[model samples]
Target chain A: MDLVNVISYSLFAIGSFFLVVAAIGIVRLPDFYTRMHAAGKSDTLGQSLILLGLIIHEGASFISIKIFFIILFIFIANPTATHAVAKAAFLSELAPWKKDGGKER
Target chain B: MFLQVALVIVFSSIIALYRAISGPTIYDRVLAVNVIGTKTVLVLVLVEFIYERPEFLDIALVYAIINFIGTIAFLKYIEKGGLT
Candidate 1:
């Protein structure tokens, strides 16, 4: 309808697209590391974009402030969690998927 | 509208859930679960707008905290082979 609503809806659509990409990636990727790459990076961007759209819709308010905190937390925590999982998998000696039929060096 | 966005997110989450169920390794399942949790947060926010309930934002915030903590805890247990 208005400029703000158009912007917000476009942002929401973009975020949803990223979310779908991440989901498909997790399902289709060859290995755990790649899946984490998909999940961590795209998920963060998707959630941030979606939250940003909602914030814009809400304008300046206490609710938007809380949404900002959620975005901040996700920006900090999502990568950390992904790294933690990858580190644990590495430490546990989980093998990375290699294209060749030989062991990875 | 927000409801359509939420519907798409729910569909994607179901796809993620498939990976969680049939993943080749435990880490894949973990990654899928984390992905789903993040999507759930977005869905929760969209639902708040759909229902015109500002208060549910608090629930979304809390869920984000719990999701992060849960992932970290799961990684720790997986790495050390124990929660302690």
Candidate 2:
């Protein structure tokens, strides 16, 4: 009914949709890296939007400031975490998805 | 409206948790857990409103940091053959 409600609802819906997309990407993607691509990038954005909505709903307060801190932490950590996982996978010599005859254990 | 959005986020969290529980590989499970953590952050903020508590945001902030550290540690453990 109010502006805050409208904005928060929209943000939540969008965030939820993005999260669903990430889930689908995980289920459908053929390899670890591709799955990470979906989960890491889209989910991060989804979280940002959802947090923004919550911050709005909360209005100006100490909590809003803490939410900002959460946002900042996510901005720094999500991508770095994704990178770390990818690097570990590569270093572990896990064979990527193969096309034809080259596939091996 | 806020309630609806929270509902959607909760739905997604359940879906993500399912994936994590059934994931075939450790990485997939980790990915699912990370997604769940992101959702949890949002949920925590929402709960602050429902409970009329400002301090919960501090909990959310701490969880975010912990989740990040946990992810990094898991990755390192996977790479190094053991957690150090």
Candidate 3:
């Protein structure tokens, strides 16, 4: 295949892997805080990578520039949104998962 | 490859939707919804290329701004205890 196809396919594969990884983390992580660690980081990166692949395929179009903008927006917004959720959880005094050792902090 | 990426995004959407619907807390649901919104932004941009419609980028931009506003408003409401 040509380089465009190769790059696009690779990005697509990587993005899919990251997305699945985030999903697994969300399901298997012990608590909300830990789950955020998984979903926030993994999902954001996954979306960006996938967008990169597709934008490259689009190749020098105005739509491609807009795609990049969408990526930028997500890069800014996803983590901020996650932080807000986590902060809200903390400020509202939502309890974390109890440790197996029964220690409270 | 383009189609594959779209499929992956859709798969992630399913996962996020699960979180949104099955959350034990309101924040978790909101987080999931936010994730879905970000994914939608990417999806919209991709759709522009897929459909050969550059105008769709305008729609994506609008969606991005609206989604950000919606998430922030939700957070503000929660912070003020108005949502609870």
Q: Which candidate has the top score in lDDT?
A: 1
What is candidate 2's lDDT per residue for B1-84, written digit by digit as tens? Answer: 556666777887787776688776687788878878877887887777777777778888888889888888887777687886
The fnat of each candidate, in order, is 0.97, 0.65, 0.60
Clashes of 3: 0
Summarize candidate 2's per-residue lDDT along A1-105 as a digit string, tens digits: 999888877887787788778767766676777789887899888888888887887799777788888888888888888887777778777667776735322
- After superposing candidate 3 on the true structure, give the runs of residues whose Cα lies further than 4 Å from its correct spot: A101-105, B82-84
DockQ of 2: 0.59
lDDT of 1 by residue, B1-84 (tens): 888999999999999999999987888888889888988898888888988998888999999999989988887787778998
DockQ of each: 0.73, 0.59, 0.55
Q: Which stretches of candidate 1 lie over 4 Å from their true place?
A: A102-105
lDDT of 3 by residue, B40-84 (tens): 877777777677777878898889889888988898897896854
Give TM-scores of chain A for all candidates: 0.94, 0.88, 0.91
Write out the backbone clash pairs for model 1: none
Tens digits of lDDT, candidate 1, A1-105:
899999888999999999999889888887788788888899899989989998998899998999999999999999998998888889889888889746322
Task: Give per-residue lDDT, candidate 3, residue A78.
Answer: 80
The true-versus-predicted C-alpha distance at residue A50 of model 2, in Å, is 1.1
